[model samples]
Target chain A: MKKQRNLTMAITGFVMLLVLHGTAYGLSDVFKENIYVPEKLAPTDSVLKVAVGEKAPDFTLPSVHHGKISLSQFIGKKNVVISFVPAAWTPVCSDQWPGYNIVKDLFDENDAILLGITADNIPTLFAWTNQMGELWFPVLSDFWPHGGTASKYGVLRSDGTTERAIFVIDKKGYIRYIDVHNINKRPPLESIMSELKKLNQ
Target chain B: MKKYFVVVMGIVLCLVVSGSSLAFDTKPPAVGDVFPEITFSIPGESDYRTYLGLSKGEYFSIQDIKAKVVVVEVLSMYCPHCQREAPRVNQVYDLIEKDPSLRGKIKLIGIAAGNSTYEKKVFRERYGVPFPLFEDADFELHDILGGVRTPYFIGVRIDSGVPRVFYSKLGGFESADEFLRMMIELSGL
Candidate 1:
């Protein structure tokens, strides 16, 4: 009778595993609905201090998964795309990073590395990005100095949040394109790709 | 015995949570319901516009599609699951096209939640997607259809000019052939 019971338990376990695999496994690993959304804010809240053709500012920042990454590390090797999102969990920010996740090859084709920056700290960024599935690029935190890098580029808003912006820097550390986009909208991917193509040329 | 019980309980909890996310969270469109009227922008490409049988228009509604059955895929370019499901979906599209009986009778399109035109374009190019895809940059189309998760599939039959849904499910499918069979069977083709 004990042997029969053990067999029954083993069978039950196998069935449960199959059910989980079909319905639940890996599907829940990423974030889903139930995000807390806030009302719309000003279109473009900050002015950019950096301009096209200016030398891009170099900084060292902590990443969610990787250790400290410096802008100078890729200065002479790869073009860099600095994406400054306003906040985590908000409407545009959540979708923007995931969109970039799909086009890693495009960035690589142009010899560019994208660095996603926001004022939210490590834990916040970790929890936020954890739901975005697997991102291909390093997501750095500008939290310690409270939007310090954003301020350096003049993207820090009056309310301490960064502007939804894009800055494309060439291999020689010169700013090639700057789009301090409207805070309420995402900078279209075509514009970014167009700018990256210029760096390739 | 206690350890075994804990493991079982953990698995059960995961199912319960995942179940809610599957469909009930936002009351997604289900079988036997009238699919919402989604006015999609006609793709600028001539091939896509011709595939949908749309002519000279900024937008066209579901009723405008010239097919007996339309397969609508609600996806997000940012969604890893959607990215993984893209190839399988493309296979389904190919199988449907090769089957002469299903050709012109069935069509496939994608509605990308929170994806802009440019983002949607990148997804199409990256996946080599053959079907026409529309952007739902603000989630308007998603909310109208009941805010479901990515990789959601809805099979609608428009035989008599009104779209009546026959299949609606969240998450991904197992096999391309199996999925195509289901769509064909459910639409009564």
Candidate 2:
């Protein structure tokens, strides 16, 4: 009986290992394939319309998750990070927001909220962003006045798309930092973190 | 009965040892160290087979490839830097393929850190990357690779029959030509 019991225990242990291995393998494969959106090259020409120490222009725009979001609401309550991308569905733009998704905790640690703005329409923004998993921040559309917010900030390209830009606004409504990155490249995350550290101080 | 107990204990010990290795927290391989062996299936088998001359349905290991030098790009489908560097990396692959001296002597592969197979496929198709790319859904390879930032490059020299990391960079290279030249120089090929 003792021999039988030992054999049973060994078999049980082996089965458990197999089950765990199978579960992990199955989980990896279960992530259903998503749509493949071809990437577009963004233009390099960018215009910076705003400067540091300026009050960020307040505006309301439609959100992908919420109906409408305004810049002024977070002025006194929270430090705001405004991330402007050139457009939706482009290589840089698509990768930019999803990168932000992983760094949401960094924004939270700095007591900031990120507002992702693009010149694409709501429908376009919805479809494009859905390709990325759930985003922790709001994505706003500057579509209808056709880049009104972008133009106000001087980042609007001649073609009506926004420049790849970032504005760190302090709680008192003053822009603390500004980066008008080349439209073709991504602004390094470390630089943004360094700027946020200054805002925290 | 004692023999059975010993046998059962041995089996249990083996299971625990194997499980622990897969339980995460393996220190990432560092510069000058032999690259750790990892088995992964590349997404889009046909592309890899045709482009890299790999066999169909075969799992790949860093030590198994026949090349004098290997460039391993640790990236993520969601990383903006990786996305921007995609075309540039393709250029590196093109140079490796087109150069008569470098042909069959150099290989390029990408590991999509923390990305699922589905995500890896999307990235591969979107970028039109001709090289083989694998998904590290559990981040096993990423953790083994030191959890470095995405768009990082690790160059391995295999001329000694044992692969050792010779170069590692945190961000994108300035240009494809510059990167290719650096790899060739570092590989001493």
Could you estimate the TM-score for every candidate? 0.75, 0.48
**Model 2, residue pairs in steric clash:** A49-A153, A49-A154, B28-B144, B28-B146
Top DockQ model: 1
User: Candidate 2's residue-wise lDDT over A1-201, tens digit each?
Assistant: 766786768766665654353211111111123322232334445567678998888899999998899989997788999999987765456656776776777788898999999999999989877766687899999998999998888888877778899999999889999988866556766677778889977
Q: Could you give candidate 2's per-residue lDDT for residues B27-91 as a string of tens digits?
A: 44667888877786634556566555557665766666768788999888677668778899999
Candidate 1 global TM-score = 0.75
Candidate 1: Cα lDDT at B81: 78
Q: Which stretches of candidate 2 lie over 4 Å from their true place?
A: A1-46, B1-73, B77-189
- The candidate that achieves the highest lDDT relative to the unseen native structure: 1
Per model, kept true contacts as a fraction are 0.21, 0.10
In order, the TM-score of chain B in each prediction is 0.85, 0.81
Residue B132, model 1: Cα distance from true site in angstroms:
2.1
| Deviation of model 1 at B149, angstroms | 4.3
Docking class of 1: incorrect
